[model samples]
Target: MAKFRKKPVVIEAVQYEFGMEDGFVVDGRYYDKSGPVPRAMNRIPAIKTLEGRHEISKGDWIITGIQGERYPCKPDIFAATYEAVE
Candidate 1:
């Protein structure tokens, strides 16, 4: 008998809401939208650490933390309102 292996899926981009708990909502979601806003808060900051364990720049591909997991998202699907972690 032979075993079958599944291929890895690829994502482009995703919309993310940065905040503590469930306060800031984006795309029908919520993040820590309450509290003192950071002085150096970047709505769409560059990716400092990710699955690659490296810095991510604009035009790069990424996914969203949905339901406590990273899901695949196409550039077009998320490009509309994709924000990096700050």
Candidate 2:
């Protein structure tokens, strides 16, 4: 067995919130914003990742990976995994 530690990397992220426009931009790319109907009929917040469309829940963090791919990460996990650079 071999052990390897994850290399530290700084990434760009934005917290998904209510009322953002459909064509809102993050990390220089535009993403469609949608979610529950209660938020004025916006589609479920999501991003097109390497795997597929991933839903972005309210309070979820949208993270841009090293290669510029974007995806959603739960707040709890994100808090435990990442920290503000400054």
Candidate 3:
């Protein structure tokens, strides 16, 4: 007989904007900060709260059960992030 295991789900962040690669643009005209800002994709997902349970969705930030760390990424990243688990 063969044994099977359930796979875990992974989440990531995604930006939602008009027409911009990675949904981020660099313009000198824009205001500048003292230090370089870590450009975050506009569509990138962070975290969300629902009913009473916790879950991860595409383009949604999440913490990996394997390492117990959280990060913001896109849906594609999420898919790749959990590819190993799945």
| Model 2 poorest ten-residue lDDT run | 34-43
Model 1 poorest ten-residue lDDT run? 17-26
Candidate 3, residues 1-86, lDDT tens digits: the string is 99998675553323333321222223322212333434744323223223222323343434434444443445666566555423
TM-score of each prediction: 0.24, 0.68, 0.24
Cα shift from native, residue 36, model 3 (Å): 29
Candidate 3 wrong stretches, greater than 4 Å: 1-58, 65-67, 84-86
Using lDDT as the measure, what is the rank order of every candidate, best first? 2, 1, 3
The parts of candidate 1 lying over 4 Å away from their true place are 1-3, 7-12, 15-53, 65-86
- lDDT accuracy of residue 16 in candidate 3: 33
> Per-residue lDDT tens digits of candidate 1, residues 1-86?
99997453443343443321223223432233345433443332223234422223344454544334443344665566454443
- By lDDT, the best candidate is 2
Instruction: Give the C-alpha lDDT of model 3.
Output: 0.37
The numbered model that scores best in TM-score is 2
lDDT of 2 by residue, 1-86 (tens): 99999999999998987653243344434456453233234445556779876666788888889999888889999999999998
Give the C-alpha lDDT of model 1.
Answer: 0.39
**Clash number by candidate, in order:** 6, 6, 11
